[model samples]
Target chain A: MKKTALLIIAVLGILLLRAAEDLPFWGDPQSPASVHLSDYYLEESYEETSVPNIVTSVLADYRGYDTMFETVVIFCAGITVLIVLRRTHRRRAKVISPRPERPGADIILQTAARLLVPMMQLFALYVVAHGHHSPGGGFQGGVILGSSLILLALSYDIQMALHRFKEKLVLLFSAGGVLLYAAIGLACLFLGRNFLAYGAWAALLGISEPEAHSHGMLGVEIGVAITVLCIMFSLYIDLASGGDLDEGL
Target chain B: MEDLLAYIISRYNYWAAIILLLIGLYGMIAKNNLLKKVIGMTIFQAAIILFYVSIGDKRGATIPILAHGHDGAHQAVEAAAYANPLPHVLMLTAIVVGVSTLGVALAILQKIYRVHGTIEEDEILETIDQ
Candidate 1:
């Protein structure tokens, strides 16, 4: 079976290589992928949305609907994991041995986490907020924020992390983030524009259309960050504790 | 021979991505341990992401972020001066979705281990047959 699998993979790889012969050379500026729509996004994204970061503008503004659904997909995955693994009552024999208890929380680790978590969170916020002008953005920022909590869980215990950020609150934040994104879209709708049309917000916010686009993108990015942050930490605690919400790795 | 070598060198990034993809496919297909399979899936995802980001690259271009003057003057944005942003934006979604899928897969694996008392695919299959 293993040999057959290897043979199939070899054939597949060869076919892929054959197909690559027709593709554009690496980093060709005139490649089809670089020309068709990408050129438009690069040339006009700044003037259209006032976001210097073309990727951010394209992701959160030009493709707002796609991003909204992407957030929903993440939210659904988190909830699926919770439903699949979470055990409310322990009736059956434990399949895995409980993690051995450490004597106590290591002072050095706790102290370092204490010092690092705040800095990490602050940096994450900066990444989310400064995404328009720089490299950082909602998803990257949210992952950073999530990792800070994971680091706290790793240094101390899952219970401690959960105590600080309760499971209920995590779920709430995850849902709330998606709601916030949709609410912005709905607000645009009620203001006499299509769903997710940031230009409609200009009248209400007393800003130019481009500035409204920028603010709308920022608002949705924050929503994405909030959902991602909560869902990431929630996934860690659930998986680390084998869905019991008890002690974790 | 010289022409062939030049061609290969120019397309090395795609070659690398394909090689990584095959390795991932092999692991996913042949590994008996469920956890190893999950790791393989992750590698597969990383390979695809790399391939996409590669497509967005330009030989003599900066990143997609527009450059502004120190005095806040807007210059004419040239399409050739910056790498493509579309693929990067799409891959951002791919990456977040990948992580979410990994979480769900790991959770399901944990549940499987709990029920079957093993994570080996063969062992689980045998138990199911019995």
Candidate 2:
């Protein structure tokens, strides 16, 4: 069986090599991917949406629907983990007690995390808010924010993290984020524009069209950040504890 | 022969991506353990992400973020002067999707382990075959 698998991989490798011959060279300026519609997205995105970051403009404005569904997909995965793994009983004793019950492992990690969590969370918010001007957006910020909580779980204890962020609240935030994104689209629609057409709301907000789009993109990104942050922590706690939500590493 | 070497060097990014993919494929197929198969899936997704990001690269270009002006205002952006942003945007979702799938797959594996008492594929199949 292993030999059969090896043979298959070899054949696939050769096929891919053949296909690679037709692909453009490394960093070819005229490569199809660069010269095509991406040029328009890069050139016009800022003027259209007032967001200087091309990636964020393209992601949250041009391809807004795709990103909204992507957020939903991640949310679905988190819910599946919750449904599949969540248990009524604790599976094992806590890995590290919050009060440094174990000597060698706890002291350093706890101290570092104590210093880092606030800084990490502050940076995550900065990343989310600064996406319009720089290289970060809701997804990156959400992951970083989630990691701060995960660090809390790892350093102190799952119980301590859970104490601050209850499981029910996390799940609610995940659902609420997705709902907020949908609400923005619906609100745009009710304002007599196409779904997810941010310019429509400009009249209501008394802002210019481009400024409205920028604000809309920011709102959607905040929704995405909220969903991603909670879901990341939810997945970690559930997976780490074998669905029991207690005594996680 | 020289042209062939240049061609190979130029398009070598795909070669690395394909190699990573094959490694994941072998892990998935040859490894009987469910946990290893899930790990293979993660690697396979990662390789695809690498491939897409490589496609977005441009020679003599800056990062996708636009640079601010000397006078503290937006400059007339040169498209070719920046790496393609589309692929990076798409792959961001791809990466999040990859993490989501891994989380769900591991959760399913946990359930399978709970039911079958072992995570080895052949053993689970043998038990079912009885």
Query: Per candidate, chain B TM-score?
Result: 0.92, 0.90
Question: Model 2 over residues A1-249: C-alpha lDDT tens digits?
Answer: 899999999999999988988888888989988887999987878778888788999999899999999999999999999889887745434332232243345788899999999999999999999989987999999999999999999888788999999999999999999989989998999999988999998999899998899999999999999999999999999988777666675
Model 2 misses residue A189 by how many Å? 0.8
Candidate 1, superposed: residue stretches over 4 Å from native = A89-103, B1-5, B70-72
> What docking class should model 1 receive?
high
lDDT of 2 by residue, B25-122 (tens): 99999999999998998898889998999989999999888776535366678898999999999999889878988999999998888777789998
Clashes of 1: 0
What's the lDDT for residue A231 in model 1?
95
lDDT of candidate 1 over A111-207, digit per residue (tens)? 9999999999999999999999999889999999999999999999998999999999999999999999999999999999999999999998899
Model 2: fraction of native contacts: 0.84
Candidate 2 TM-score, true structure as reference: 0.93
Report RMSD (Å) for each prediction in the order shown: 1.6, 3.4
Q: Candidate 1, clashing residue pairs?
A: none
Which model scores highest in DockQ? Answer: 1
lDDT of 1 by residue, B1-130 (tens): 9999888777899999999999898889999999999999999999999899989999899998998764656878999999999999999999999999999999999889888988999999999999
